[model samples]
Target: MKILVTGSEGFIGKNLMAELRNRKYDCIYEYCRETDSTLLDDYCKEADFVFHLAGVNRPKDQSEFMDGNYGFTSELLEMLKKHENNCPVMISSSIQAELDNPYGISKKAGEDLLLNYSNETGAKTLIYRFPNVFGKWCKPNYNSAVATFCHNIAHGLPLTVNDPSVVMNLVYIDDVAEELINALNGKENRVEEFCEVPDVHTITLGEIVHLIHSFRNSREERSIPNLNDSFTKKLYSTYLSYLPEDQFSYDLKMNEDYRGSFTEFIKTPDRGQVSINISKPGITKGNHWHHTKNEKFLVVSGKGVIRFRKINTDKVIEYYVSGDKMEVVDIPTGYTHNIENLGDTDMVTVMWANELFDPEKPDTYYLEV
Candidate 1:
């Protein structure tokens, strides 16, 4: 189907176009400020569906809001009417339309025009009054607070919150895109008069700032955010997308010794901690037994032999491991274990502990295996 998308260069428009292309729709007519004015008439004549997303949210003068929002919408509907085309039209409106401000008033006017056109021509119209939308491609420091916070915090810039108690309703860009596609398939989630993106995240300004700050600090702390929460997962994904191109990678502090180096890769409170361990050829490490803390070790490089011995028992259990055929060895309580590099090259092992090690009360006791 041929789809015409107005304001195609914008955040929501770009996301919707990408999703449409991803779903294998190729004949899309994109109309933005840069496009030639005469092409809009041809696009309107041939369009099977129209996504009317053009609007002026932040203009130099207050009058531009009405011109860009309502005036342009009227012109587009007239062009479609002139061509005798009554295609399904979907518009991206703002939640601010319910208020009395200039921007809101302009958006409401556009909505009324679309409804009138639909009533006169019997055309299908979908209007979505979206909340604050955020995602990867959203521009920072513009209209979106989430975008600004993600960009500033990622770049080590300062953030200012005038009112911490203010609550914001947020909708992710993916959800918005999905909902638009569903509307194209005649599956819109309509309530009374307007359609909506089903998943909305309600959070305070203070809570959002706190979560973003924690995302920034996670690098230094060698920790991962709890992604089980849907809002946090989407927010974290948005935050990482704002990282400066040159600052994509950060160094992790590695504890080095004569045997090799060990670095903690990631730590989580509920899950566990993961570390990378290296040992030189013929070097042995981890000659200890844990009272309660258990671990899983997987040799990823070179060859090694893992030896385990139960306390007060002489029988030794050995597991030969190599990078060619990797295996995980579980270290249970009451058993002393050690791993020795048997290959000529250095051996690398990945270790996972059930919990973070506390120096104040170490449950480890040195014992030979």
Candidate 2:
């Protein structure tokens, strides 16, 4: 079915789009705001379903939150009521809507607008109140509490808990995305007023921190570093060594199959080298681009595909080679690339580069194809 997704640039919106695409659903993204009404109306007119997930969840002040979350949603709902042709709407609300924060108050108002509009227009309205969502592409400082804790623990920072006793439900973003896809596919008559999207597990802040530390510690033990002597110290060293020399950064294990440890690598030098080994076929390393480093790769063994693309351009080049005919592939600095093992044998490659990996800098970009 043709579906319209609002706030398609935000974290949840991005995850939802990925999930929908995986399910083979026809979906279109639209950023809804005061200035984008015409574009939004055009999308709504053609959609069989509308996932209204736009608006800000946090603001510097209460008025900003009100304007961003409540006001924007109210206006969107009014426009939907006038322009939409009875397309079902799935509104992504927040658990904060039940709290007293300005974010919550604004979300409550947005929900009311959706329900009232649905009652008047005969449009199906489904509201999802999400708890703290974690996993994959979550930005620590801006996303949620789990991200903050994970970011700290990944980098070997002591999980600083303002209150360790406070319990929060942490749901995986994949789970939430799957639920959204399910809702989108289900019969419209089965839609409910509200759903508390349950998490696979609920954890305390302290537990979350410990989990990350444990994972990172386990990784260091298994890696070439073999830091079984003192996992904490080794992790700290590993983190410091890999961190961008000029800036502070951390790495979160977003994918389920992240084989290497979740140790946060910080760069402390303008130029350095970090390496990993892929011992099996089907292992892929990095679909990311760096703006700073001119990376070079040597095929230690086996066969693989080295795919690279220039930034902001559609020009892409793929190089396929095997162990018997090994060659060093030079990826031009400031390009996106990934190495995937295509041969039946293990592909051992060494990534030696001079660019420091920085998450905040516009260095790494992700591509699906």
Candidate 3:
């Protein structure tokens, strides 16, 4: 399918483009920063679907919001009306558009413009109202609560809750992308009306902050054996300051089998064996060369660097990895390798071997520092 996507440089647009690319669909992207109507129309002429996502998400001034969001959308609809039997236009509106904010008002106007154009030209138009979508690769300045929370938690900052009782819907970016793809693949008649993409989960701000604190505290406790009362009391005191007056029970649960940096273990399956370990920041582990044991490394938490040197050769390679990225770095046998945790937190890894782990006659050969 030939798809023309506007706002290709934006977060949602980038994700949608990647999804379409993975599905083997032909995608043409036009960034509003670099191109405008003539280029967009030419691309739309050959498209089976046109996803209109170009607009100002939020602006400090009301006039800028109207010009950038409403005006841009109106112009695009006008250009689409000129085309004969133009492809179905999927306009990405926001849940904010349903509210009274200036940003919301402009977005609502954009939606109305698309609907009016669709009515006049008899073209297919689909509208999507999205909630708080959060995930990796998010732009930091977008005022997304999820991004702010993730940033704060990752950096070990104190979480502040404006209201403990207010609950808001939160949706992961992957889920939102999945829903959009489903809509694209469905019959055109099925998406005739404006569709509201509901969040999969609803959580309160206070709950989110506490969950992060608990996860961090649990990880710290696992690494520090025989922690003194003073340190524990200090951590608890800091946590208490971020909460309400009443004692609130924590409903958040941590994954015990997470086996990340703070939780390390060795698992032996009948078919194969897997060993994992956590490295604290400024520490280096796994400097030994493996003879026949191949391993997969993932930086489960925090940022880190991996350096590998080929045996009997001057060739060397280095890679930087961070949290929740599924990038697997394969370590070939007969190579000397080491990884260093560069961030302020723990760096975790899960390693799988084809055979059982042996300490004395291990496949690893240590090299002098």
TM-score of each model, in listed order: 0.96, 0.58, 0.59
Model 1 lDDT tens row, 1-369: 999999999999999999999999999999999999999999999999999998899899999999999999999999999998999999989999999999999999999999999999999999999999999898888899999999999999999999999999999999999999899889999998899999999999999999999999999999988889999999999999999999999999999999999999999877789999999999999889999999999999999999999999999999999999878889999999999999999999999999887899778999998
Please write out the lDDT profile of model 2 over residues 150-196, one tens digit for every residue: 56665556655788778876566666787777777773323256865
Q: Candidate 2, clashing residue pairs?
A: 242-266, 243-265, 243-266, 243-267, 244-266, 244-267, 245-267, 245-268, 245-269
Please list the C-alpha lDDT of all candidates, in the order they appear.
0.94, 0.67, 0.67
Q: Highest lDDT: give the candidate number.
A: 1
By lDDT, the better pick of 2 and 3 is: 3
Best-to-worst TM-score order:
1, 3, 2
lDDT of 2 at 299: 75
Off by over 4 Å in 3: 36-38, 187-192, 221-263, 266-369
Candidate 3, run of 10 with poorest lDDT: 222-231
Off by over 4 Å in 1: none
Model 3 per-residue lDDT tens digits across residues 96-207? 8889988899889888888887888877788887777666566644667655665566555665668877786766666667777776776332434676554455777776
Candidate of highest TM-score: 1
Model 2 off-target regions past 4 Å?
32-37, 187-192, 198-200, 223-369
